[model samples]
Target: MTGFIVPGSPEWLRLITPSKVPAILGVSRFKSQFTLWHEMAGSVAPAPVSERQQDDYDYGHAAEAAAAEYWKWKHAGWRLSRGEVQLRNPSLPFAHLATIDRRASRGRSRRVVEVKTARDLYEYGDDGSGEVPADYAAQVLTQQLISGWHDDADLVVWPQYGMPRIYKVPFNEAVAAAIVARCAAWVESLRAGTPPNLDDSITCYETVRALHPDIDDVEIEIDEGLAVDYLELDARRKEIEAAARGAKTKVLDAMGRARVAVVGDVKVADRRAGKHSIALYPATKNLSQIQEHAA
Candidate 1:
């Protein structure tokens, strides 16, 4: 009772997966709901994966095996199984899919084991606390709902510099139900050709730009209030930048003849040499005149 369709395939794009749950709920850091809507509606194509991004994806997949082995070694009694297994619920009105990383079983109890490779534990909580990022929690919760394994799931996160930690995630019926409802509505919106409202996230901004790449020479008047707000924000931003540059100048002046600055045990800043030379002073009209002419 498992699916054989590969992820990211044309067919897979038609169904709502656990990974897309976060986007629908507006908790995903990488993508906004608007962006997801456009992608699912086939109005805009997904961004092309970069070389470095592909390498990271490959590394994460390879790390999952090591994480699985670590999980087995850490819990000797539990049995773990992993494969290209996909699950779904035909009883649901909308198409939803889940491809879990691993499944752990002990006696009659079953747990979904999700392996994540992170550069740090900033988004996750203490070991065994069941606390993870909202997006990650949504993903696992959706998995539990689809697989019908409501037992406490194991989220094994392997940090780049530390030992792998296991966080227990217990499924909540209310949350899972909300996720399904929202997802169903989202799917209906897709079918009705109603896109989600745009948000302030960079993903949404980029998606909007990508969707309308060609610009018309015709000018259109926007809201005057919006224009005023943007101008005010831009002016404030320039002020902040100038103040930051002044502070940096003072710090560099204080650290003259020293490559690094420190206070007690805390290292402050390191002025290292780079390919491009750093300009200590701003290139103002007077500074430009001094540079062009003799002192």
Candidate 2:
């Protein structure tokens, strides 16, 4: 009951782990609830992991150990239980499971510690405030709910640069209860063969494509209203695209030989040399400033 579960294994596929809580709550950037539902329902196979994704996973595991060591050094008195331990509560449904990165305890005071590697601190709060990403909060909350270590948890984030920072996440009983309720309902839905509605997430789109890879040489009539809506949306999209292209050309012309275009202190666009051609990437952080500057 306390060990790492092999990912993609039969048992792992049947249960909802702490990491999957984000997708269940529609907060995960990498996956959608619909995709998770189908994968767990055995309707479609999980997508094959790309080489880049595999490399990230490998780096993450290695970073976890380093993070644990850092946490131990910071809290010398606290006993750190470092391992990929899978914790489960018999009282709850088997679907509700957790595999925490580390658990810290000092004479009965126990807290969960989660290690994360981020490309930047854009999604995190650099201030000492305990603000963290919603997906990460969900994962920690699920871990606390399962482990019964509900006092508080720590999030150790190792950014691509700089030293790792620790964020203290206080437990909220209401949020934990809500998570459990939603997960239970999701499990019931999966048991009843009810899949979640589709969304525009890339994972959901990929899942749908995989579900129907073969194209049938047949025509079927869709709703007339839906068809009209699609056509109108397509026209609007093309118009917007054309306007964007014209604006981009104007910006590039203004830049001339300059590699970067900035509005005040904010960088609006930058040119990068690609294999075939030079690519212009827009930052879009201060679009209003860029627009005013352009005007």
Q: What local distance difference test score does each model get? A: 0.81, 0.83
Off by over 4 Å in 2: 123-130, 239-295
TM-score of each candidate structure, all chains considered together = 0.80, 0.82
Model 1 RMSD to the real structure? Answer: 9.5
Model 1, residue 255: what's the lDDT? Answer: 84
Candidate 1: list runs displaced more than 4 Å: 123-130, 241-295
lDDT of 1 by residue, 1-295 (tens): 6448777877887789998999999999789999999988888888888998898789889989999999999888998886545788876779878888998899988889998887545434332234687888999999999989998888899877567888878899999889988998999899899998988999999999999999799999999999999999999999999998888889789989676555543344556554496434321223334444544
Error of 2 at 271 (Å): 9.3
Best by TM-score: 2
Steric clash pairs (candidate 1): none
